[model samples]
Target: MKKKFLMVFIVIVVVMTFFTPSYAKNTVEFPEEDSTELQYQDMIMLFLGSHIDQAISDHYSFYLKKDPIVYPYQIEVKKVKRINEFREFHFVIILEVTPVVGPHITVGKDKLIFEVSPTIPGKVKLLKFEHLETHELPPVWMHLLKKKPSL
Candidate 1:
């Protein structure tokens, strides 16, 4: 009985050790319009904008032989959350991509979350990019064609 009790106590200790939570804490904070917040916001926006431009170029480069333009609008910072030592920012951005001579344009609105370490500047990382809306406008000629067919 003495040996069995000792084994049980050892097993319980091992189990408790594995089940204990880590010391890291998570906190959520809203971003303000102060200089520091603005700097971080700009950094994240530039990073995300570059990514969006690259994605559009890679997919629609052929359509933009003349002049390619990408406009980012309606950027809003939703929330900021800190997990351990990293700060995560949640926001939404709307992008309009125009192929210089193409009749169809692509509009995309996406909500994204990015993580960065305040201790290590310039080490921004994207955690998530969720598309809220994405669609391509049909060319005017296509609409005319449909109208003629109906007539």
Candidate 2:
């Protein structure tokens, strides 16, 4: 009877483990309304969370593959400043981003220049994006993008 009970318990545990919902490790979190820079950072994080692997491969790989293998990456929002606010304004987002490799590679200092319109009824567009100078990346991150390039 004891052996039979143990077998049934093990089976139940296995079934529950297989049926449980697995949550993704990374998520995009943003405030409802904040500085333009914060909003831009949130948008970028959302974009990456959706297409992280593909984006990494497109930027780093030579061979094309259906699903590009990628590693865990993160971004630090260094600063957000508003230049001008009219119908639309240009805001600066200084960010530090890490890249991925067979083993995650730390890509050093990075920044993105964004043109954003204040929130509207339904949608927000990333009007323009440009890479900025890579300053000293923390030892954990390896810096790339030597100079600002229009994207």
User: Which is the leading candidate under TM-score?
Assistant: 1
All candidates' TM-scores? 0.37, 0.33
Candidate 1 lDDT over 23-43, as tens digits, reads 322212335545886777566
On residues 5-96, what C-alpha lDDT tens digit does candidate 2 reach at each position? 99999999999999976432232343576788666656766644434433444443432222233332356666656656653454554444
TM-score of predicted model 1? 0.37
lDDT of model 1 at position 106: 37
**All models, RMSD in angstroms:** 22.2, 11.7
* Candidate 1 segments whose C-alpha is farther than 4 A from its true place: 1-48, 51-72, 85-106, 118-122, 141-151
Best model number under lDDT: 1
